[model samples]
Target: MTRTLRVFRWSPGEAERTREYRVEAARDTTVLDALVEVQRSQDPTLAFRYACRVGMCGSCAVVVNGRERWACRTRLGDLGAGAVRVRPLYHFPLLRDLVVDLGPHAERLRRALGAFTPRAGAEPYARIAGDSRERAAIDEAIECIGCGMCVSACTLVAPNPRFPGPAALNRALTLQLDSRDGAGAARWGVLLGEDALARCHGQGTCTEVCPMGLQPTASIIRLRWLGLSRLLRWTG
Candidate 1:
């Protein structure tokens, strides 16, 4: 079967435009596969990113038909015979065709102290209980692949660019619940900042778009409750 892919294209100084390419697709043909065919045969200039075609790397994430999805995992047959509209993830600077600069997403993670800071001078190979509350709290959220889809889907990001997006906040929650993480007060300071946890409106769009099925909205809510409890303990 033939499918039309309406892909967004742009260069450094070029005006943004959508270019359509028709490609032969099988039931198992993925958006990434079609894109590869387009780049190989249809248009050599078409640009996009994909590392692991099996969807583990999260590098192939893009906006598909108005939703964030991993192009490598999106089957053309699943799109229901409509022209597949492919665009770079929203809330990010467009770098080129189907590629967006991920620097902002990284910066947000950095600002949220997303990196795990081990307890200083702690013993190597410290073990955590598998059934502990901390482990349970982060089990679902710990698998985040750092794809910028949640950030792109977040409604608060465009209006408030300072907000450390859902992915970052979700990472923060994981670290905050980690018994081995020494970020502690410093991490909490960032989490409770004017543009951090409070900025999240709990819209769940992040949860909806997360390619990893992580619940960032629930993480944010957990962080909010933890923050409030910490504050009350200090005052009580």
Candidate 2:
């Protein structure tokens, strides 16, 4: 059985026209597989990025049939119809077909001081109890692959790129709950600033789109609660 792919493509530095590629595919082939065929057989200039075809890397995220998904995991049959629409992730600078530059997202994660930084009397990484509340909190959020599917779903990131989005805030939340991290106050300060936590509108689409089954909306909710707590404490 042959399937047809309706791939949305726009070459970099070419904004005047968008290119559509219709290609034949096998029933067992995924959209990413069909895309590779189109690129290899006809257009060598097509650009996208993927490291693992097994969906572990999370680098193959694309908009297929109006939903954000891991291309490697999305089979042709999953699309059902003969046509599957493929495009770059939304709310970011499109680098090319099915690819968006995530530099700004990376920068925001850095600004949050994403990794663990300890206080003077903090226990060693090995000393931290596996079943501790902070450990459990961080464990749940640690599965994120930074695929930006949540970013694509977020309406706020469209208007405000400064908002940390789900991935970064999830990263921040993980660190905030770390038992050894002396940086909670500092992390919250950056995350709660005008351009950061204050900007989330709670659309909850980020939770809906995450492939890892993580609830970033919950993290953002916790963040909002923390921010309000701090405000109350300060005002008192």
TM-score of each: 0.97, 0.89
Q: Give the winner by TM-score.
A: 1
Q: Which digits, one per residue and each the tens of the lDDT, describe model 2 over residues 91-123?
A: 878777767898877876887787778777765
Candidate lDDT values, in order: 0.92, 0.80
Count clashing residue pairs per candidate: 0, 0
Once fitted onto the true fold, the runs of candidate 2 whose alpha carbons sit more than 4 angstroms away are 16-18, 121-127
Candidate 2, residue 16: how far the Cα is off, in Å: 5.4
RMSD values, in order shown:
1.1, 2.1
Considering every candidate listed, which one attains the maximal lDDT?
A: 1
lDDT of 2: 0.80
